[model samples]
Target chain A: MTDVLVVADHRRGDLRDVSYELVTAGRELADETGGDLHVAVISGTVDEFADKLNREGVDAVHTVDYGEEFNHGVYTQATTQLYDELAPQYVLTPNSVNGLDYAPAVANELDLPIVTDTVALETDGETLTATREMYGGKVETTTELEGPAVVTIRGAEWPAAEGTGDAAIEAFDADIDEDALGTTVNGFEEVGGGDVDISEADVLVSVGRGIEEEENLEIIEELADALDATVSASRPIVDNGWLPKNRQVGQSGKVVTPDVYIAIGISGAVQHVAGMKGSDTIVAINTDPNAPIMDIADYAITDDLFDVVPALTEEFH
Target chain B: MKILVTVKEVATVEDEFEIEGTEIADQYLGADLNEWDDYAVEEAVQLQEAGIADEVVTVTIGPEDCEQTIRQALAKGADRAIRVWDDALEGVDLLDVEAKTEILRGVVEEEDPDLVLSGVQSGDDSWGATGVSLAEDLGFEWAAVVNHLEHDLEDGIASVRRELEGGVEELTDVELPAVLTIQTGINEPRYASLRGIRQAQRKELDVQSLADVGVDEGVVDSDLELTDMYEPESESDVTVWEGSAEETAGELGDLLRDKGVAP
Candidate 1:
């Protein structure tokens, strides 16, 4: 029987959605290994987080009330200590920004092999096979590694575990060495506020790298003007200073669920898709027929955005 | 202050390509400097220009074929370069994080710098763990996904803004002699100037073997193994408008009008 231990993630008083998703991932692995599923919620209203994380498949909840916000040193210490006590076969965490900060350190501290951003996992007791994407989602690969490894799962790949449970919750006091702590979190700030808020717009005309140059953005602007839509963009455009940070849509920028999102010349990377996948209607205009944007698009024009966008603008005029 | 930047030459695939076994066909692949690393290089160069950093060196874990990519960093104002490679690493399909951490640990130990800057993740493997993993091995502080770094390192502290999901940025202070994984949009990575490119030819780029770096050949034995590779099947059920540009555009316009989103 190989146990699976999952760490829950939360930010600023609320449990992030990925925490529940990790539960679902943990439950599936536990069912395969025929072992109990353990969940650890460290810091920030630990009892509340533990109650919420007590989903159907969880067998126990371990709370370590260490700090108010995420400190990698505290997390690495607590997780490693838990691994020592429980000796679970697998340690799972969300492949999130916070997860990236600490997961690798925990793996290093424990001297375990680490696989990150995995989309799928299957274990036959000894060897664990993880499926992840490479080359910006162009390809998927299966990686196999021996047991007692650390893994991080990407967001939204698994359904969030639901239903209340009668799981045993306990407080696990972890010894935190304050002298060893190196980083300090000052606070958080909300960025990207400007003249326009794309999230509030009914329709958005978003452009990406396929536009080729900064000057080519004029056609996208004209299309948005003709359709009474707001102009937004993927990361490269914003990174290039062609667009303001506020107009960028992605994991690091804004999440827009407009009534219509017409992605012109945009290959929808996973981070880009995470922001706009919830739009009521999605349209893609790109030369590459196999671009990832097409996967979630309601309608698409598999042609040059330069030609298609101008003609589409003319139709609106 | 001395700064060491970890650089990589990543393989880029064309839109239309074929997979041969567990690898993309070599014919359709092109090599370039990792995008995020460009921003990291720019940050390091800017720090040097600001007079805060006395030297900026770059280290890479790749073959001699990656010298051109390393020179790209040198052309962008990095002082010197170190390339770590060995015949033992020639046949490994995928260099896992543990192996990479050990190889990089060897370099970090030799170069004992005040700070380290690396890309948040590589363009190809995208493991996104090497920077922090290296920090842990060496017992140094680390901050990942940092976008805005204050040039002023007062009291031996580095203040940075970590770009989080949904437009939130976490302000954090990391004690110096640390590692920072740089994010994109931190700075506009300048194009290598003609004069800089010419000067880059004269810059010192040293190549080292595993033995040279004090890493054993056994480090090549990675725990992670690549078993399968394929393109993700298109799960799209999209209605593709196939026709001339004007025809398809007209179809999109009609749909917009019918949906009451356009005039």
Candidate 2:
């Protein structure tokens, strides 16, 4: 039987939501392969993290106690050691900043093929068929990979795993080579210190390329104020210097799951959708009724954002 | 110090893309330098201007047509350009991250740069793996999705701020001769001036084959096979609102209030 291994991702002692999402993905793949699902958690205190991951669909939780924060050297050593012992058919990780840092090194060391930012996966006999987007989500490509590979799943693609069970927890020690590590973490710096974090806001008023110029952001800010929502933007607005990078929402920016997300003049590219698709309710105001964003929106208004935004602001006020 | 920046040329497609069998329609408006790479080019140029590095070399793996993209980088202040291509690579699946990484490894070996920079992800394939995998092969320290970077030539170390999920950023220090995949909006890339463009035309634009880079043709074989390519299906449960702007806005507000999102 082919087993599936999922590497849990965490930060500052908290398990990331993607860890459960990886379980959801791993469970499905494991069932298809007629095998058990295994989870590997590497942290300073493994048992605390391991206990939280002993949920249904997982057969075992492998814990490796390392430094407090994620260290690339420690992760690489622990993962490779775990892979050697488990010898699972597939290893899955989140396509996050931390996951991507050491995943490639592990794959390279093991001579395993890897695919990144995979949105969908299916089993074809012993092989795995993965789906990803290209051209800013304008095109979708389905690729078939040989078994016994490593893959990174995109956030929000699969629902978070739920239900509970008492899976066994096991600890493993890794041989970390200090001399091999050439990078050191100096600490984290907030992108915009003291600025409102749009990701934490319950309601978001997000503008896109249609905002046209920096001066036009005032209207968006006004709408945000009326609703008590925070103002965010798509990548183009940030790239143009119309907004700070911290305010951008997309694959290259923040992945937010606000209660309400109001997208103005946004075309809803796959990259942008990957970031905010988890919003409880999405509303789109665009001139094109056929825009991709309209398809996923709960409520889509096919009117000029200039007119619709002000009207919405006035109505809310 | 020498810095190497990797650039790519990508096709920009608009509405009505035709799928000609296993390939996209041959006709395209035009090709330009990949948007993300522009930030890498800008950072390299700025580093050179700041005297952090004396030479800025740019490289790409594409057809002869990609020279246009290299010239654009040179005009942006890159000192030289190298294009790696061969007939064996023609019609090769571009999403082959492993093979592409190996090809780039060949170029990096030849350049022997003190620092390597590339876009966090390409606009076309968007795999976002080449640079990191290359770093692995070279046994160099690396950081991905870096937005802010500073180098200390004397100390032989570089400090970078990486953009992570949920608007969080991490500060890390890596020994020199590392690799960094630059994120967009890191800096504003400068436009090419008339004099700069003229100077770029005279700069060295070297074209090398896979053999010249010490990579065997057989290494181009891809690990993954493309089964299909198409547009995604649109969501079917969308509710399209039709009314005047004011009326629609009122309806939207009512909906939000009913959903308990608005007070």
Query: Clashes in each model (backbone N, CA, C under 3 Å)?
Result: 0, 0
Candidate 1: tens digits of C-alpha lDDT, residues A1-317: 77899999988898888899999999898898688999999999999999999999999999999999999999999999999999998999998889999999999999999999998999877889999988877789999998799999987778899999788999999999999899999998877654476866889999999999999889988998999999999989987788878789875566777889999989998779867876889999988998889999999999998899999899978
- Per-residue lDDT tens digits of candidate 2, residues A1-317? 76888999998778888899999889899888589899999975689988888878889999987777887777877888899999988889998888888777778778888888889988843789999987777778888878688889987778888888678888877777878878788887666634456777789999998888789899999998888788999988887777777888877788888888999999998789867877888999999888878768988888988898999899877
The CAPRI quality class of candidate 1 comes to: medium
Indicate which candidate wins on TM-score.
2
Give the least accurate 10-residue stretch of model 1 chain B, judged by summed lDDT.
B161-170
* C-alpha root-mean-square deviation, each candidate: 4.4, 2.5
| Tens-digit lDDT track of model 2 for B1-263 | 99999999987776567776545686843588988899999999999999888999999999987787779999989999999989998877654767777888889998899999999888877878778788988887888888899755468788888877666788888887889999887888899999999999999999999899999998777778888898777564778889999999998898878878785
lDDT of model number 1 = 0.91
DockQ of 1: 0.57
**What TM-score does model 1 achieve against the real structure?**
0.87
Best by DockQ: 2
Which segments of candidate 1 are over 4 A away from where they belong?
A194-232, A240-247, A250-281, A285-292, A301-317, B240-263
